[model samples]
Target chain A: MAAVNFDKVVKSFGAFTAVHGLDLAIDEGEFVSLLGPSGCGKTTTLRMLAGLEFPTSGEISIGDRVVNDLAPGERDIAMVFQSYALYPHMTVAQNIAYPLKKRGVPKSERGAMVQKTAELLQLTELLSRKPRQLSGGQQQRVALGRALVRDPKVFLLDEPLSNLDAKLRGYMRVELVELHRRLGRTMVYVTHDQLEAMTMSDRIAVMEGGRLQQFAPPTEVYRAPANRFVAGFIGTPAMNLIDGEIRQSGGTWQFHAPGLTLDCPPLLDSARPGPACLGIRPEGVVFGSGPIEGVVQVVEQTGHENIVVARIGADMRLTGRVGAERVWQAGETVRCGIDIDRAHIFAAGAAGERLNRPGLRPVEAPAVIKAAR
Target chain B: MIRRVAFNLFAWGIVLAVAFPLFWMLVTSVKPQFELFRRPPTFLPETWTLEHYIRLIQDTPFLTYFKNSIILSTATTLVVVAISTLGAYSLVRFKYRGRESLAFLVLFTYLLPSVVLIIPLYLMLVSMGLSNTIFSLVIAYTTFALPYALWLLRSFMAGIPEDLESAALVDGASRMGAFVDVILPQLLPGIISTALFTFILSWNEYLYALVLVNSDSARPLTTGVMNMLVSSFNIEWSLLMAASVMMSVPLIIVFAFLQSYLTRGFGAGGVKG
Candidate 1:
């Protein structure tokens, strides 16, 4: 296994830039995911690492060897495409043995290696069948088998599980984690799905608009996002970002929006009292009794919880996860409470920097109001 | 139910109308020379005789012309298909300056009538001293066949997903190695269909064959069969029909072998990926 490093890499297509000044270092045998939305540079970064696309400027090294001019085959890397890209004309056995054959492995050894890989992927039974004859999950396994037989220094996967159904996607997600564990190889996974990145990565690199927004462990990325984009992009039902301004009042800070005001935690010395945004996770927005009141607009039932989208004022809307046992109807005025310690404050814009520090998360609330169970 | 029946009947009527001449050619080949001017033409020969077919094979230079046609068509098909397959692959996959205009130019050449090219092609062949040879016809045929074959195969090449080649490249195959292993197999059906078209085109080509070669040794069946009817004053209809039947046998065999791929090739060759 090898450690992969990108040093200030930038990829541009003539006038348009895809990735800009990306510097990421993945440790040996670590599962690092490049996560972002579509048109974000996640796929481009993975392709450059795979040697399918060369970087416009910067150095990429696999285990101390810079591979700037190497062709994909010369890079000693294998990739599993999102479409699986199994050779339609070749059977499962041939598909798995393709890399071995390409590398001039002898006939006898290729058979054994292919058989071993097929067994590892549980594809031995389907070895004689063509790619079109197999189901989507089976094809995915064969694609993985093709990559595994090579036993390259690093495995690059570009949304390999995106093609499968939801249940199969989940199952394959666990299978991929197990595979990575068994092999103990460096793997760089590129995915737009935040759940895939959060659940399987050793470290997640959150990217947007061709720039690295944050690269940290999954929990850290979730608990302390680097910017307002990461705060809004990483979570389900999305983090509620209320645009407001913070002002110093009576030695503490108060955040004010259109029809809402809340006491902020003790600010850091660098904290400026200016235009700032408040970010709270859906779980942090309690639906019982607190300082602010809001009318419920829509309740989305997801079996285990009710996701309530409530209008706090004429403009601000908050989404809160509440118990499914208590049904919430539209136009009902409910008291809302923001978890002050857990809530994040950011400078107010799309690419705003996170203002709240993790060290300041333990401050007590201004009031003793409790949320209903 | 009645409307469906009428539709079926109409479709069968059209099929039969198209197939009538082929049926008549077969029937006419087996009939005796005396039955040629019968008051009403016989749908089936009353006295079936293989005399016309036997005489045409034994007493004429039909075999020589058949051999020439086979050589010309096969050579044209091999050379044109080989060049066009690579050309279409490059046109569809590679990014280069003038790539779009180059593809458009190929179709532009195809749009030009073959008749317009004959005189200039004949002059060039004569100056090169390539006139009256099978190789010359192959070259002449390529002038028309290459563009047509390339245009057909371009769409077929585009229909193949680019990801498959990327997968192969990452799997340690060189670009050409990936092409031989991944692309050739996917393009086999398309190549077969294009070959079939080019072969049929060169085989049935009359104008170039008539103008370029006068020797019986280099004559293809289309013009050679006409020579058999014109060289004689009597104009033996049975002999002409017999030669026509023999000319279609190779195509019929080729169609039988490639029927499944032919339909698929046509359907996919029109749709761009």
Candidate 2:
């Protein structure tokens, strides 16, 4: 119902800084995910917005009012913790009605609201049971029901589905997206799982070392990551990164490494060619026959697709995805074609900013190059 | 099978060894005065008599002593549990300097023996003009019970996740509301166990009761029963046994009522379950 904004928020515990100069603005009814690896300050950022943690400096606001000094109760936010922190003594109905009761809602109205919320969560049959009597998924639903029944201005979920089984996680992911659609409340979800952030978030904020790395849509993050960390962290088998130098070969500029060489994209024509990192997605490394030849080190079948890890030389290893029908074996000499137009190029050192290429728009094209005979 | 049998035998031996004193007290309370003085002690009385019980009720102020013990123990348990709960909550939830050392200091107090401090405590009470009063016994009992009560409840409070209370706070409840609505309920088993422990400690306490109170009207059952042996030249063994049995009945009932909670794992299903 309200936009949440963090303006240069920094959090530290004693001498250790957990979040550093964070600035983010979540629009009304937006489902934004704060995604990062563990200890990356994603949860700390969410807790600061929830008023559970006070920022060491800077301001956080929900709607137009700055909430830096407000208590969590005064912020009118509901949070579903990763542990599904349900009151063990209260039954499912009572758990759902707790927020309403705390707000001093009358008995009859609270009862009606509890019934409605439980029915929405498909927990009507389990209302009489305590949290201990319910299944893991049921306990999760009850936690969700408790947060939802209050109908707060913003919903904060900290890896809520991480406790469930794999199958249940998948089910809950869809259900959560659907719930967000129905409610259309500003929700800030914190998770380390990239798939969850990719599948559910309208915009994902990828973080590293207590700082925001990239904030963009899922496709933009996948097709055009802002930095090397986002490039490596956002994908499944992860993007293959090769450290090499760009040098003038014959007349055109070419990237050269241990056992690889490819024409540099025209985007680098203006810069003095030095050291750069080449990033290629698994799908971008087509594995039929092309310029790059390597021995397949390992092949893993994931039912839907095959992931082939190939070593091109003494030092470089690249993974490529192929159709399930194309059987690959270890030690097999396989040639792969790198999608040069779709590949990402970054500076060699720590702050690896992406180098923009003129011909490459953030659009999917089957620009498959054939092997040289 | 042989090892299992040996283990069972060893366990039953310990149980019998512990139960023998209570068994002897019950049987001796019902024995007639002549049987109590018999050379070969009777495990089972030849003739059970109600004369000792009748004498205890009619001759002595045994009822008044029993009533005073109940009031003192109940008051001590209530005060100890309330003070310890708040103290334990502050110790567990807040992050201040010396928090760990403060908890350590409370545990250190429990290590000090009551007999070591009884003389100074008695002198202080006399100077304060609090001697021979039931209120003095209550105050002494609470001081003895508080350290252990705080230590027990502090550990129990530590097992409860802070997330439960944080969730409550975000659900529109104030800090105190979260403590009362979320934490207090989960602490039920721990509180029950602490109350039972303090109650039993106060009830069976003889040292403090002996030093703090002397008047029959203010004396607890423990000291009052000891006074009986001194009042008569010939010790009435049957009457003493009857009084001992009566004093232990309330303790047995309280233990039986709260035994399950006392031994249960607090916060079992609060998090993952």
Candidate 3:
């Protein structure tokens, strides 16, 4: 097992930056995920850590040693690619045995190791069969088994489960977690799917536009995202942002959007109101019994759950999650409430920069200069 | 239907045009000596004879020429195939400064026509005392064959995903190990077709063979036939045709056996998407 560290690493293809000044520390035996949307540099960062791609600047280290110049094999890291690029000419047994054979392991030891891995992956019966003969899931297991047999310092997976169907992806996600737990190896997985990141990772590093947005435990990231982008990316319905003045209405603070307003969370009142964006998660947008009102625009039914998309005003929409039993319909004006304790106030001048509660502010956000008096 | 029938007739006319010389040669080989001068050609001989084939084999150094052709062509094919495949793989897989330029240079070797380079090559060979040797012919054949082989195999290798080898590399393979295990096996059919082409090319080549060779020792069958028919102006047309018949037989048989690789031949020009 190894601790992988990337120190201010930057990767560029010519002038176009692919991964920008990424610094991360993945601890031994930890399953961390690099999560983001496509083209967000998650794969490039994983490749750098795997030594398949070189950094344009800065350094990377695996365990105690600096592995910046190490070839992929020398770094002792194994990667399972999305395509499950098995050697087509080789049988399952040979494919799994490739690493050992390359290491010049003796024939008897190679046979033993391949047999053990194949059995662990439940590929014993398919040992002599070629990759084409195996089902997709079986080929995936072989690709994974090929990595496991190496007993590498770290396991790097570049969207390994993305190629599988949804149900199989879920199954393999659990299997992968179990495998990591059993072996206790450092594993860094990359995926654009937020659900995969939330379910599989010990820590999730969320990225956007080639830069790190937040790196924290998955729950923390989902609960207290560092910026607007992280806030919107980690959740299912995506957090709602209604842009308007944070005005004092009848001496009780309220979050305001055009043609609509809400009772503001008490925690936000200490700071003077200004042009701010009120952020609330769809789950926090309650179904009934508060001042906020909207004409129901659309109701999406997903079995036991309901997603209500409503139009509160011209050019503004709000989404609320309710039980499927609820009858919120289009053109019906529905009363709802915001869980004020969970509401967030971001400065418009800062443009979605978080108002980091109490006496402090984010270091990047300077002293308040433009708040409405 | 009318256009289809017209197309069929046109195609058959072209085929008959191409096969007419071979058909005439075959009939003349078996016809009696006097039948060759018939006012109108004898489509079928009144009396067939083995007399021309027997005389041709016994009177000429046919066996020596046959052996020379096989040795030079087979050796050239093996040498060219072996070297070009490795060279093509490196050019395709490895990225380095000047790689594209180097590939252009390999292609440029083909642009140097044999006729223009023959005098210098012959002078060099004579100085090295290799002018009439089979080894020299192998070297000459490589000059013509290497570029095509390299171009063909390089394109074939390029069609294979680099991700395949990267997967192997991460699976604990060295770069060379990945090439041998993952990429080379997929290239097998391409290499075989390349070898077959080079072999046929070297087997039929007569330009360099004629220029450098002064004796029967290094003469391949094509030159040996020409030398015999020309020197003996009162040539036995039947015997000459019989020799041509024998020379073409091996190639036909070889092609018959390896015809499945026409699909594999497509692997060379190539498996380009």
Candidate 4:
């Protein structure tokens, strides 16, 4: 296993730049994920690490050897594509044994190695079957087997589970984690699915517009997003970001939106409060009683929880998660509470960098606020 | 029920209309010489004769011409498929400057009629001392077959997901290795169809063969069969029909083996999900 380092790497395709000058370093044997939406350059970054793409500038090193000029084959990496990309014409054994065959391994050795890999992936019975005959999940296993049989220094998986059905995708995600633990190789996974990145990576590198927005553990990223983009992008039902102005109301800082006003989180008082964006996680939007009031516009029951989307004004909407037992109907007035300690405040500017409250450590925010100051 | 019957009848009508000429040729090839000039043509010959077939094999240099056609077609197919496969793969995979224009130029050559190119090609061949040689025909056939072959193979190669090759590259295969081990296997059906296409093209091509070759040893079946009308007074219709049937046999066999791929191959390579 090898550590990967990217130093100010930039990738451009003619007039369009896919990846800006980006610096990232992954520790040896760590599973890191480059997570972003489409066209956000996450795949481009992974491709550069694999040596499939040459960076326009800067350096990349794998275990202290600069690999900027190396061919993808020379980089000692294996990749699992989103499509599985199993060879349609080859049997599972041949597919798994391809890298060994290419490296001029003896036929007997290649056969034995392939058998071992197939058994590891529970594909021994499928050794003779072509990829088309296998189911989607089976094909995925074979793709993994092909990569595993090589035992490359790093494993690059580009949305490998995206093609599987939802249930199978979850099953494979856990399997992948087990596989990573068993092998203990450096793995750089690229995915647009936040949940996948959250559950899979040792460190999640959230990116936007070819720039790194945040690189931290998933819990840290979830708890304290770096900017408004991360705040909106990382959560399910997404974080509710309401645009408003912070004003002094009877000595307490209050956030005022179109039809709702509430005491601002203590964090806002430290900053030069003007126009700011308030980010509250769906789970942080407490129901029952609070200063802010809204009429429930929709309540979607998702078995474990009901996602309650309430309209505060003509255009402003806030979604909150409540237990499935709490019944809410459209047009019912409900008082909502914002968990101030859990909420994120971003400066109302183009960058929208997160603003921290005074006297609170960066990593530790209080669980509950007595009242918003 | 009536609509279905009408549809079936219409389809059968088109099939028969297409197959009738082939059926007529087969029957006409076996007809006796006495029935050749009958005022009203007979659907079935009164008596079948093998005299024309016998004459074609024994009297004429038919075997030599057949050998020449096979050699030329096989050589042309090999050369065209090789050049086009590489060209198509490069066009689809690489991001080099002028690639789009180069692809456009290849298809542009295909658009130019071979008839318009015949004079210049013949003169060039003559200057190179290749006139009246089978090599000249092979070159001419390759030139005409290359563009469409490249076009078809490019689309087919493009249909193959790029991620497959990327996976191979990251799996410790070189670009060329990935191509050979990964891309080439997937392109087999397309390659077979292209080979058949080029083979039939050169086999049936008459204009270039007629202009470039004069010897019986170099002449293909298409031009060789025309030699039967030596004089209008002695027009060997039965011999011509027999030779025509023999020439089509190879094509029919090829199509029969590859009919499914042939129909699908045309529509296969253009779109990818």
lDDT of each: 0.88, 0.88, 0.82, 0.86
Per-prediction interface RMSD in Å? 4.3, 1.7, 4.8, 3.5
Better of 3 and 4 by DockQ: 4
TM-score to true structure, per model: 0.94, 0.94, 0.84, 0.92
TM-score of candidate 4 to 2 decimals: 0.92
**Candidate 3 regions with alpha-carbon error over 4 angstroms:** A243-257, A260-276, A288-293, A346-353, A358-373, B1-57, B97-140, B208-215, B231-236, B261-273
lDDT of 3 by residue, A193-259 (tens): 8888888899999988889888998777766676778877767677888788777767777767767
- Report the error of model 3 at residue A152, Å: 2.6
Residue A112's lDDT within candidate 3 is 89
The reply for model 4, stretches above 4 Å from the true place, is A246-270, A357-373, B38-47, B260-273
How big is the positional error of residue A18 in model 3, measured in Å on the Cα after superposition? 1.9
Looking at model 4, residue B213 earns an lDDT score of 94
Tens digit of per-residue lDDT, candidate 2, span A273-316: 78988888888898978988899999988777888999988888
- Model 2, TM vs. native: 0.94
Model 3 DockQ reads: 0.39
Interface RMSD of 2: 1.7
Model 4, position A94: C-alpha lDDT score: 89
The alpha-carbon lDDT assigned to residue A368 of candidate 1 equals 16
Q: Which stretches of candidate 2 lie over 4 Å from their true place?
A: A246-254, A266-274, A349-351, A357-359, A365-373, B126-129, B230-233, B263-268, B271-273
